[model samples]
Target: ELSMSGGALRTFSRCVTCLARIGSDLVFQAYPDKLELHTLNSSRSAFASVSLTRDFFDHFHLPADAYADAAPSSTPLQCSVLLKSVLAVLRTPTSAIDRLNASLPNPQASKLEFVIHCVSGRKKTHRISCSAESDVQTLALDRNGFPSRLAIRPRDLTRLLSNFQSSLQELTVIATEPAARLPGVDDGTGGKAVELLSYIDPTKDDYDSRLHTQLWIDPAEEFLEYEHAGDPVDVTFGVKELKGIFNIL
Candidate 1:
């Protein structure tokens, strides 16, 4: 069982909406110390997870022997439900919701129950059908393994992305060091920059008339933190996923 205060309920709603935009199903993994929500895109290329500590909830409860004598590799209680179903229960604005109570009840339960207490002295309950899942699908990634890192405000990045056409599907980001290209020719103003370019396969039949766009950004001005310690590199990914994630932020 889990209960969230008004503030936490707001955050939880946003998290659910964000996850819904990323994937079709939401996975719940309950542990003694925290609750985790995870989702993977249909193509299995994009995966996202959010962890909420016990303290984040107004009330959190689990059986004392939930993990008793369990091996280190033992899996936690896991289940999945359609993202849209969860969204239906959370469609009410946070301002109208005073508190949220959720419960799995037991391992055999086929539905997850959510009770929402409204600020206007009303109560609503929703039962979302769920299915037991054998395990959670997650990607193991080491952040430090990447030589380049940039931290920018979500709004800042969103503003930059706005320069592209709405129909554009993919984007390529190129990171470069101006000084590396020409050692002696490097001007005092030489610094790191990134080029955001709209991408479309040239092999496509209509490529000849497709619009091509490029925008250059200086990290020093746009990013709160920027570090790069290797050769220039470029990565291309779908823009729709990025826009969806940022929208929730």
Candidate 2:
């Protein structure tokens, strides 16, 4: 059983929604001191994972009998649950809950129960059935190995995204060592690292046509740093999905 404030529940629900975007079925792993949720996209191109510590909740309990055997330390309790089912119960108004207690009956339990304690002394209980079995791919990103890094504030990226049409798909991020250009929007200065966000559109009339929107970010001013020793580091991502992922983060 896990008991926590309403705010923590809401935050956790939001995290679940983020992984739900990748897929419906999710694998939740409960360790002695932490909980992990993870999912992967259909194409296996995107993955999301969240790790929660005991400190995240007001009270956390794992009954010794809940484990399949006495040696639970060697095997954490793992369960499969549908994201939609869990979200349906957790999407309640935050104000309606004073606190909540969630419990997994046992390692083989078929459902998880959440007891909502309302401020008015009214109690509500909700249960989301567990799935028979499922699998989730583990995503391991080596951020330290990423040669180029862009540190633009969230608001700035959101504002920039607002300018592009919804049909705009791919966003390419490039780190440049500055190039010669007019002293207008893209005045590039040498020795200064410049980051560029390019909205790719194959429908444009000409390849060189300036119909695409390009936003130049001054890396020095933004404190964006790179550790790569060679050419510019470039990476591309789907703007639509990335926006949702970043917003959740």
Candidate 3:
């Protein structure tokens, strides 16, 4: 799942290209999502809206004349607009999909679906049939067998874990010198990256500037699957190793 923000066609275009370059399974989002904001001075405030690049660009495309102008910050996003954009992008021209297909392992089999299962004041039990083959690829993210593991009511434990993980990443970035490029490594896309980083504050003076990077390595966990077998579990993050990475070990 990606949580990048932008309001121009170029900005979003670059992000979509990146997501396509990397093998992302699904794009998850919330309606009227609140954004966390911090200025260069590090003070914070928040604004609520339907947040995603696709929604922004589809409605607010950057014209050649307005290429360098600042993007819209005053306009609050519309939920219906986002829904429309989502539908359109899912059915994006096959030629576009094929352009990024080379970067993916099995782009043809990939399915990007919006999960709309609501459990409001209802008791229901969902079931999955056993696989045709006894051994099958079973990928379960945020699997809570019971309610006890949740973070108060419907708030997913996995979402909380992810936010916590993000905090860890920020802390790791803050600690590294020459600045941390340790987390997200640009895929070295043969210089056609479009050079737009999402999650970055474009209003800042450093919009065109490059950065110091960080990349975290998990020897045991591969993409979409952990090497471990059996019930789903949370991995204990290595803080001591993190300390070592920042030279405090």
Instruction: Report lDDT per candidate.
Output: 0.82, 0.72, 0.26
lDDT of 2 by residue, 37-153 (tens): 877666766667889998898998777766656576656677778888877877777778899888888877889898988888999899888886665633457888766555667
For each candidate, what TM-score against the reference? 0.83, 0.73, 0.19
The candidate, 1 or 3, that scores higher on TM-score is 1
Q: How many clashing pairs per prediction, in order?
A: 0, 0, 8
lDDT of 1 by residue, 1-249 (tens): 999967888889889888887788899888888898998788876677899998999999976655666742345666789899999999888899888899987856799999999999899999988954523444456788987888999999989998999999999998876445565565443554678999999899999899899888778889998777778889888888887777895
TM-score computed on alpha carbons, candidate 3: 0.19
Error of 1 at 205 (Å): 2.7
Scored by Cα lDDT, where does model 1 land?
0.82
The best candidate in terms of lDDT: 1
Candidate 3 lDDT over 1-249, as tens digits, reads: 122212233343433333332221213222232221111101111111113433442222222222234333432211111222333443433322321110111212232222221223222222212112111012222444431121121222233233333324222211111122334666443222111111334476965773423333222221232232333233223332222222210
Could you give the candidate ranking by lDDT, starting with the highest?
Answer: 1, 2, 3
Identify the leading candidate in terms of TM-score: 1
Q: TM-score order of candidates, best first?
A: 1, 2, 3
Alpha-carbon runs more than 4 Å astray in model 3? 1-7, 33-249
In the order shown, what is each candidate's alpha-carbon RMSD?
Answer: 3.1, 4.9, 23.5
Clashing pairs in 2: none
